[model samples]
Target: MADNASGDTAGDALPRERKPSNTALAKQRAHIENLMQNVDKPIELPQPGSKKPLLKPPPEIVLNVRGSSAGAGSSDFHTYRELRRKEHLRIKLMEAEAAEDAIGEEFNREREALKRQDEEKTAKNRAKRQKRNKAKQSAKKSKPAEKAALPVADE
Candidate 1:
């Protein structure tokens, strides 16, 4: 009993399961440390007077929309504004199509609901008409019998 109690205590003191260490996390930490060390060095730059300009001046820009020879030889370049305008128009077209589809679906649903309501109303009206006709026929049959009995009594 003492040995069993001691074994139980030992088992309780130790963890029931052990989790494995993640190697990916260690590799990521090492990479981050290496990047930090590499970026910690000071950078050297040339003096303003010691360095020369690397680029030349840009050429003048001229736009001709009348099929003139001024811009005839230049390569056609699509500007950012033109691209944005095209994208805007495409987005508008898509929005319009989506709106049209949604409206069409709503209209179809409403039409079906109205048709069902109309059918229900017509069924009720038919029932009322049949009841009225039956009442009128019973009244007509009773009146004819009463009239025949009165004539026989007079004779």
Candidate 2:
């Protein structure tokens, strides 16, 4: 083997050591100091009962329906039961749809009632304001007529 000037073989090379910068060393020292301060303080753990959900989704009344996987034109008992299962699922879906529609109709009726009530209130207020303005105008018109009726000396 040819000898190099450093007198160390390439296969026996040691890893180069590194020294951290002053800023990094200071940051590490500060982190350790902060950790030491927290060592005496008790860690507040979460309570087990707090894991309960705040709100739960509404229960599903209608389930998803998948088509029958049986072979076509087969009139076995499995196929008959599959047809019955589909009928039941369809009935459940119809019932759920009807229930949702009823809720929507009720909401619309309530909104319509509220709209009519608001319109009536505003119309009454408008009528009262018109009457008040007309009264004020009539009082002003009478004052001028009364002054014209009074006999006055030439100024």
Candidate 3:
């Protein structure tokens, strides 16, 4: 019986006999009343959105200027100097690498040019050898024909 009484009293938290707050407060209190009524059995959510929307994000506030610490103190100066030193070293290393790459590229280009020249020279020499062989073959054929054409001397 006590449990049933508590269950009956659980939903009657707001007194209907008394008047409620006005404006947004009344709407919020009404929503709370609706929520309390459906503690176990939900019926419907508050219509037309919440009275005071709680899901809104807070405003953004900038806490510090960009690189403000760069000119702040001795520690900042040391950090700035160290960063600049590293940047300079990085640039120097990049320039050295670029120069090395250029040198290597030129070396490869020269080597390829030399190879092409050698190949062309070999090709020309091979063509000359072929021509010489063909001429020798033709001369040998003429010599045999000329001997056959001449009168054969007494054997």
Best model number under TM-score: 3
TM-score of 2: 0.48
User: Residue by residue across 61-131, what tens digits does model 1's lDDT show?
Assistant: 53534365565343345454565676676667668778989999999999999999999999999999999
lDDT of each: 0.73, 0.77, 0.77
Give per-residue CA lDDT, model 2, range 1-155, as digits (tens).
35776688775787667765579778899877887899987666776785322433333663533458845454556766876776677677668778989999999999999999999999999999999999999999999999999999998
Error of 2 at 43 (Å): 54
Can you write out model 3's per-residue Cα lDDT over 97-136, one digit (the tens) per residue?
A: 7898999999999999999999999999999999999999
Between 1 and 2, whose TM-score is larger?
Answer: 2
Question: Which 10 residues in a row give candidate 2 its minimum summed lDDT?
Answer: 50-59
Alpha-carbon shift of residue 2 in model 3 (angstroms): 99
TM-score-based ranking: 3, 2, 1
Cα error, residue 42 of model 2, in Å, equals 61
